[model samples]
Target chain A: MIRTKDIFKSFDEKEVLKGITTEFYKGKTNLIIGRSGAGKTVLLKLLVGLLQPTSGEVWYDDTNFFSLNKKEVRAIRMQVGMLFQASALFDSMTVEENIRFPLDMFTNMTYKEKRKQVDSCLERVSLSGVNDSFPSEISGGMQKRVGIARAIVLNPRYLFCDEPNSGLDPKTSIVIDELILDITKEKNITTVINTHDMNSVMEIGENIILLYQGEIAWRGHRGEVLESDNEILQDFIFASPFLQRLRESALGK
Target chain B: MFLKNILYHFGRYVMMLGTAISRPEKVSMYYKETMRQMNDIGIGSLFIVGLIAIFIGAVTAVQFSYQLDGTLVPVYYIGYVVRDMTIIELAPTFTCLVLAGKVGSNIASEIGGMRQKEHIDAMEIMGVNTAAYLIMPKVIAALVVIPMLVAVGAFISIIGGYLASVPTGVMADADYIKGLRSFFDPFNVTMMFIKAVVFAFILTTVSCYQGYHVRGGSIELGQASTNAVVFSDILILVADYLLAVILTS
Candidate 1:
């Protein structure tokens, strides 16, 4: 489990995260949903120790992440995996090399063993036979899958995905979402995804924290999202015409 | 604000270099990466270096022969002039300029593209020391390979001068050798080596730094590459003058 207590972060004079507190439970999909610039990415970065909080503590299990030195932080990071917004695969390397990067860095596995592990991870992501292909040669969805494969190659205890559904078609987005949720459940890893896609919320909003202007607007299951009386979430939910029609039907208005 | 940011990045670079030195695994990776970069910067640029050296040597020899105007000037002096110029200045300085175009731009664009794509951020998330993994290797490779390229350039230029002098019939080969030997200074040789080393350091460091800190996107990466060469070129001229003044004094 990952926990943030009174986390405060600011850029220059503007506070991006205003004394936010949240607990991300293990073995479930925890979604951080917000409009653009609602501090969703900042919060995610803070949780992962990419950005240090101005004042507060982030605990991964029992260790205070901010308080630890860089080496210690790296040790913690090794146990965690992140799929970047842009996929972040090294362009110069082939897909196989990209997947093998972390193992090459931190592990002492023989080349054959590493190859076996990489092959299995690729198979898990349904990306078999594209090992020699470059990221540019593949489709966007395939690149995201590669990102996920690279993230999970180490068998991390925690997985964080930033805007995993961005730029993908609706159907592809759901597939990626299902892949994430399935991996989270099977591996029993603490999974936190930052997104605003309502379909994802409906599909795997097992635990969701909605942010509005840097504060927690609502936190609950998917079923509770439509039922919640929070005006801010209501405004966000009904703002889209598609969702507005869905809201009207739900409320019988 | 920009100055502060540069200072902050400089500090980060120093800390990363320190980490690279202290960690065994990191040092090994750095060596492997450096070898790869050396091959790219040195071995890959050989053809261009050879082509340029041949033309420059031929031109210098022909011009000198024309100026001598039937005076008993040893054709071998052409070899000496080409050798000295190539070793003491042209090879080191000009080759770096060429590299600043070829290797330097490549480093800048590659690293800048990585930054723009958030690959550096990805490395950070993975607990990788990106500076150690990326920048230091290029630095070390430049230091090792640039001087060697300069030597090769000198050799090529000497051969070019030899071919030009033999065909022109300005003077006998023996007299040319005598003139070259009489004026040869060991200090000058040392000076050229020193200059090559300094030029290599400046070129790679500045180019890598420019690329490492590039902002925006592909357009910015292009801008960074241009900035790297321009900045390094100016620095090279300034450093060259300063070194000449100090050494002569």
Candidate 2:
């Protein structure tokens, strides 16, 4: 589990995250949803220690993340995995090499053992037999799967995804979403996703927080989204007339 | 404001060097990366270095021959001039300036692209000391190979002077060889190596600093790469002057 205490972030005196305190549970898909420029990305970066909070504490399990020394910070980082919006795979490496990178860097595993682990991860993401292909040769959806394979190759206790489903079609988006959900449950890792995808929110969102102009406008599970009467939440979820009609039908209005 | 910016970059560059030279996580992996960089920096640069070196020596011989025309100075002085100039001034300084344009810009663009693509952040999050993993090998490769390139350039330049002067009947082959052998100071060779090593370090580190701190999109990346080359050239020239003063004094 990860928790943030009054997390505040600023850049050049423009406060982006204003006192966000939240808890993301283990073994669940925790989503931070907001419109553009709503501080979702900033807050997510702060949570991952990529950016320091202007003032607050990020507690990874029981330890304060910022208080750790360099060596200790690296120790914590070894247990973290992140999937970038662009997948962030090393362009020169093949899929197998990309997935095997963390293991090669951090483990004493033999070539055969690393190969076996790579195969298992490829199979887990249903990406077998394309191990030798470079990321440029794969489709966007396939690249996301490869990204997930690389992320989980280390078996990290915490997983962070930044807009994983962006640039994919609906069908591929659902597939990627289900893959992330399955991995979270199977590994029981603390999974945090920053996205504005409503489909993702309705489907895999176990704990969701909505940010509006650097403040938490609303927080709830997906099942409560249609029932909630919060003005901002309704304005956001039912922005489209089609979704508004669907909400009316679901609520028996 | 300008001074503040310089101090900021200077402090940051020094700190970056500190992290970049830390203990390696794995000796074999570092070795593998170092070898790849050696191949890239050495083999990839041979053709350009040799091409410039030959022309540099040829031009120096031809120009100096023209200057010595109708004068009491011996024709053999053309060879001597080419030898001493190539060793003490032209080889390390000229060759490294060209390399600062070629290899330095390339290093900046490569690292900047990776930074924009979040590859550096990914490596950092994976517990890799990104400064060390990405930079140490490049620095090592440059330090080791650049001096070797300078030595090769010096030898080829002497041959180039011979080719231009002797083949055209400007001077006899024996005269050129004798000029090369005359007034040969070993300290000049030491100065050449000293300049090469210092120039190599400056180019690699300065280019890396420009790339590593790059933010924003493609436009910013382009500026970073340009700054890398420009700053490296400026710094290499400055270092050359300082080393000349310090060593020759």
Candidate 3:
């Protein structure tokens, strides 16, 4: 579990996260949803210790991440996997090498063992025979799959995805969402995702926190989301014509 | 404000450098990084250095022959001039300029790209020493390879000067050999080696720093690459003059 207490982050004098506190639960898909520049990414980064909080504390389990030394922090980071918005695959490395990277750095596995592990990860992601292919050779969706494979290669306790479905078509986005959900459930990991996709929220959002500006505007389950009477959430959810029509039908108006 | 910012960053860079050195695992990573950088900068640069060495040697010989005509300057002194200039100045300074252009730009672009892609942050998260994993390798590689390149450049230039002199019929083979032998100075050679090492250190350090600290996005990375080469060239020229004045005087 990851918990933030009164987390405040600023660049120069412009506050990006404003004294926001939230808890990301274990064994479920915890979604932080907001429009662009709404501090969703900042919140994710802060949780992963990529950026330090200007004030307050980030706790990974029982230990305060901010209080740990560099060495201690790194140990915790090794157990946390992040899927970046861009996939962030090393362009120079082949698909197999990409998956094998974390293993190579962290594990003392032999060449054959690493290769076997890479193959297994590729199979899990439904990617095979593309081990030698560079990232540029693969499709965007395929690259995201590879990114997921790399992130999970170490079997991290916490999984964080930042706009994982960005730049993908709606269909591909659903596929990525399902994959994240399946992996989270299988591993029973604390999975936190930052996204603005409503379809993703409807599909796999077991727990949801909606951010407006730099504050959490609302928090609830997916079922509660469509039924919520909050004006801010209604404004956001009904902004989409499909959801607005659904709302009208459900309300009999 | 700009100066203060520069100073602040400079202090950060120094602290990072110190941190990289203090940790054993980081030092090991740094060693590996240095070897990789050496291979890229040193081994890959041989062709350009060779091409320049042969042409410069031939041209110097031709120029010396023209000037020596109808003068008391011994024709044999052409070889001595070429050997001294090639070893003590051209080999060290000119090769460094090429390195600054090629290797420096490459390092800057690579690190900038890594920063843009958030790989540096990834490394930090993984408990890897970013400087050791990134910067140390290049530094060590430059220190090792630059000196070797200087020696190769000096050797080629001497042979090239001899061939050029022979074809021009300005200096006899025996006289050229004698001049070369007489011009050899262990102290001057040591000075040249020292200069080469310093040049390598400055080039890699500045380029790496520029790339590692690149802000904004991919466009900023391109800007960092350009700035790295430009700043390194300026520093090399200044260092060259200072070293020359100090050594010769």
Candidate 4:
């Protein structure tokens, strides 16, 4: 579990996140949803200790994230896995090598053991038999799966995905969402995803926080979204006349 | 403002160097990375170094021969001048200047691209010290390999002088051979290696610094790469002067 206590972040003269306090429950998909400049990414970065909070505190379970020494922080980070928007797979490494990197760097496993672990990750992602393929040789959806495979290769206790479904078709986005949800449930991990994909918010958002102009404008589960009646949430999530009408019709109003 | 910017960058660069020299998380992983870098920086750079070395020697020999005409100096002094000049100056300075353009810019672009692509951040999130993993191997490889390349360049350049002068009959082969053996100072070779080692450090670290701290997008990346080459070349020339003074003194 991750908790932010009145977290605030700023860049120079501008503030991005203002006093965000929330808990991301373990074994659930907690999403931070916002418009382009609404500071979702900033919140995620602060949570992961990439950007320090200007004030307040971030706690990964019982440990204070910002107060730890370098070695201690690295120890915490070993249990943290992140999937970047661009996948961030090494261009020089094949899929197998990419998946094996964390093990190679941090484990005493032999080459055969490493290869077996890599193959297991590949199979978990339903991407078996592409071990030698470079990232450029794969499609965008496939790359996202590969990124997921690499992220979970170490079986992290906390998972952070930044816009995992971006640049994917709706069908592929659903696949990615289901994949994340499954992994979160199976691993019983704290999964925090920062995204603008409303489809994701509706599908896999077991818990969701909507940031508007650097503060939480709405907060609820996916089931509560359509009936919330929060003005900003309505304006942002159901902005389209078609969805607004569909919402009205579905509500039988 | 200018000096302030310079001091800021200088401090950051020095701090990065300190961070970059740390112990690796895994010794075998570092060993693998170092080997890859050795292959890339050493083996990948031979043809260009050899080609440039030959031309530099030919040009220096021809220019000195022309300048010596109708003078009191012997035509054979061309070989001695070319030999000493190549060893003491051109092989290290000119060769490193070329590498500052070729290898330095390449390192900067590679790292900068990784930064922009979020690869460095990914590694950092994995509990890896991105600076040490990415930059140390390159620095080690260049320090070891660049001096060896400079040595080869010096040897090849003397052969180039023999080719340029002996075939054209600017001096007798026997006289040129005598000049090569005459008053040869072993200290000059030491100076050459000293310059080579120093220049190698400047180019690798300066380039890595530019790349490691890059922000924004493609435009910033391009500027970082250009700055790496430009700063490395300028620093190399400055270090060459300082080394020349200290070593000779």
Candidate 5:
């Protein structure tokens, strides 16, 4: 499990995350959902050590993340994997090479062994073919799948996805979400996702935190989402009239 | 404010170099990258360096020949002057200035594009030393190949001088050969290599620094690429002067 304690992050007198304390459980899809400027990205970055907290403690299991030196932090980061919003694949490398990058950098595996590992990761992501294709040659959805394949290639203990569904169609988004869910369950990894997609929040939000104006407005699972009386959560989840009507009709109101 | 900005960048640049020189996570990966960079910065640059060098030598020979027409200096002195000038100053300084525009901007754009695309962050998240992986190979490749390029440019320039003057009846072939053999100072070649090495370091590091710290959209990326070339050129010129003073004295 990953835990944050009173995490406060500020940039030049402008505070982005105001005392965020939360637990991201193992083997569950923990979602941080909020509107733009709601500190979702900042909170995610702080969790990943991309940005430091102003004052707080991040516990990766029992170890204080901030207290570790650079080498020690890198040791922790080796067991961490991230899937970026834009699927940050190396443009120059083939899909196979991209997946094998972490292995090549960290392991003493032979060429054939690395290729086998990469093939397995590609298969796990349901991307069996197109190994030699460049990132630009594939569609955005395929790139995201490739990104997931690369992320899980190392079999990290902690997985972070930043806006995994952005720019993807709803159907493809569901596929990506299901893939992440399966990986989390299979590996028992701590999965944390930052997203604004309401579909994602409703579909696979095993544990959810709603950030509003740099604070957690509400916290619950998807089942509790419909019945929650939190005003901020209600306003965000049902912001669109279309969604509001859909939610009302589903409730038989 | 200006002083603060300079100090800030200077400090960051030093820190970046420090990080970049750390022990590699994977020696083979760095080796492969260094080889690729060597090809890119060396073989990719040969044609342009040769073309510019020939022109520089031809111009120097022709101008010196004209200047010598009404003077008491022998016609053979044109070859000697061209040889010394190309070896001591023109080849290293001029060649590096041109590469600061070519290879320097390319490095900046490549790294800056990676930054904008989140590739560096991805690597960092993977526990790879992004600074070392990205910057070190390029610096090493430049250090090794650029001096060789300067030497080749110096040779091509001497040939260029001979072709321009000897073929046009401006001077005899033997006189030019005599001039070429006139004064051979081994230290001047050492100075040329020294300048080449120093200039190469400045251009590569400055360009890498610009790209590594880039933090915005296409406009800012373009600005970073431009700043890479501009800063490298200015620093190369400054280093050239300093080296000439220190080495010659």
Candidate 6:
């Protein structure tokens, strides 16, 4: 589990996250949902040590993340994997080489062993037989899957996904969400995702925290999201008239 | 304000080099990267370096031959002047300046693109020392290959001098060969290698620094590439003057 204590992050005089304290439980898909400028990205970066909090403590299962030295922080980071919004894969390397990168760097595994591990990861992501293709040669959805394959190749204890469904179609988005959810359950890892997709919020949001102007406005599971009395959540999530009308009909109003 | 900005960038550059020189996570990975970089820096750049070097020698020989016309100085001095000038100043300085324009901007753009694409961030999150992995190979490759290029340039430059003067009938072939053998100083060759090594270090590090710290979008990336070449050229010139003074003194 990952926990933040009074995490306050500011840029110059502009405060982004104000005293955000929350827990992301292990083996659960913890989603941070918010509108634009709602500090979702900043909060996620803070949890992963990409950005330092203005003043707070981040505990990664009793290990104080901020208190550790550079080497110690790197040790912690070894067990952490992230899927960027753009799926930051190396352009010059093939999918197989990209997946094998971490293993080649960190492990003494032989070439045959690393190749087996890479193939297994590609198989797990249902991306078999495209190992020699570059990231540009594949579709965006395939690239994201390759990104996931690379991320989980190391079998991290913590998996962070930033906007995993940004440019993907709704059906593909659901597939990606299910993949992440399945991986989380399979590994029992602490998973934190920052997303704006309402479908993701309703479907895979096992533990959801709604951030409004940096502070936590509402906290609930998907089951409770529609019934909650939080005005900000309602306005933000049901922004479109079509969605609001669907919500009203569902609530039988 | 200007001084403060300079100091800030300088401090960051120094700190980055400090991080870059740290012990590698995997020596084999670094070795692989270094070999790839060597091929790119050395073999890939061969045509341009050789082209520029030949012209530099030919121009020096022709100009010096004209100046020595009807003068008390021996016609053979044209060859001597071309040989010494190419080794002492022209080859190392000119070849590196051209490379600062070509390779320096390329390094900056490659790295800056990676930064914009969040590739560096991904590597960092993977517990890889992004600085060491990205930078050490390029620097090491430059240090090894650039001096060899300068040596090749110097040798080609002398041949160029011979081609221009001997073929044009401006000076006798025997006089040119005699001039080439006259007053050879081993220390001057040492000075040339020193300049090549120093210039190589400056260009690669300065370019890497520009690319690594780049922020913002495409416009910022273009600016970083430009700055890489500009800063590298300026530093190379300054270092040239300093080395000239130090080595001769």
TM-score of each: 0.92, 0.99, 0.94, 0.98, 0.99, 0.99
List fnat, each candidate: 0.70, 0.70, 0.40, 0.78, 0.78, 0.72
TM-score of each model's chain B:
0.87, 0.99, 0.92, 0.98, 0.99, 0.99
Per-residue lDDT tens digits of candidate 4, residues B67-174? 998999987798899899999999999889999999999999999999999999899899999999999999998999999999999989998888899998888998
Sorted into a CAPRI-style docking class, model 5 comes out as high
> Model 1: which residue pairs collide?
none
Q: Is the docking of candidate 1 incorrect, acceptable, medium or high quality?
A: medium
lDDT per residue (tens digit) for residues A44-97 in model 5: 888889889999999999999999998999999999999999999999999999
Q: Considering the two chains of model 4, state its CAPRI-style docking category.
A: high
lDDT of 3 at B57: 80
Better of 4 and 6 by TM-score: 6
lDDT for each residue of candidate 2 in B17-112, tens digit (9 for 90 to 100)? 999988887878888898998888889888899999999899999999999999999999999999999999999998899888888988999999
Error of 5 at A1 (Å): 0.9
Residue A207 in candidate 5 has what lDDT? 98
| Candidate 5 lDDT, B30-100, residue by residue in tens | 99999999999999999999999998899999999999999999999999999999999999999999999
CA lDDT of B222 in candidate 4? 96
> Which one wins by TM-score: 1 or 6?
6
Off by over 4 Å in 1: A251-253, B1-31, B63-76, B246-249
lDDT of 6 by residue, A1-253 (tens): 9999999999999999999999999999999999989999999889888899999999999999999998898899899999999999999999999999999899999999999999999998899999999999999999999999999999999999999999999999999999999999999999999999999999999999999999999998999989887999999889999999999999999
Instruction: Estimate, for each residue in B1-249, the C-alpha lDDT of model 6 and write its tens digit.
Output: 999999999999999999999889899999999999999999988999999999999999999978877789988999899999999999999999999999999999999999999999899999999999999999999999999999999999999999999988888999999999999999999999999999999999999999999999999999999999999999999999999999999
lDDT, residue B67, candidate 6: 85
In TM-score terms, candidate 6 sits at 0.99
**Comparison by DockQ, 5 against 6, better one:** 5
**What's model 5's lDDT at B142?**
100
True contacts kept of 2: 0.70
Ten residues in a row with the worst lDDT in model 3 chain B?
A: B20-29
The DockQ assigned to candidate 3 is 0.51
Model 1, span B149-244: residue lDDT tens: 888887787677777777567656775566456678888878877888888877787787788889887788889999888878888888888988
Q: Which sequence of candidate numbers ranks them by lDDT, best first?
A: 6, 5, 2, 4, 3, 1
The lDDT per prediction is: 0.85, 0.93, 0.86, 0.92, 0.95, 0.95
Interface RMSD over true interface Cα atoms for each candidate: 1.3, 0.7, 2.2, 0.5, 0.4, 0.6
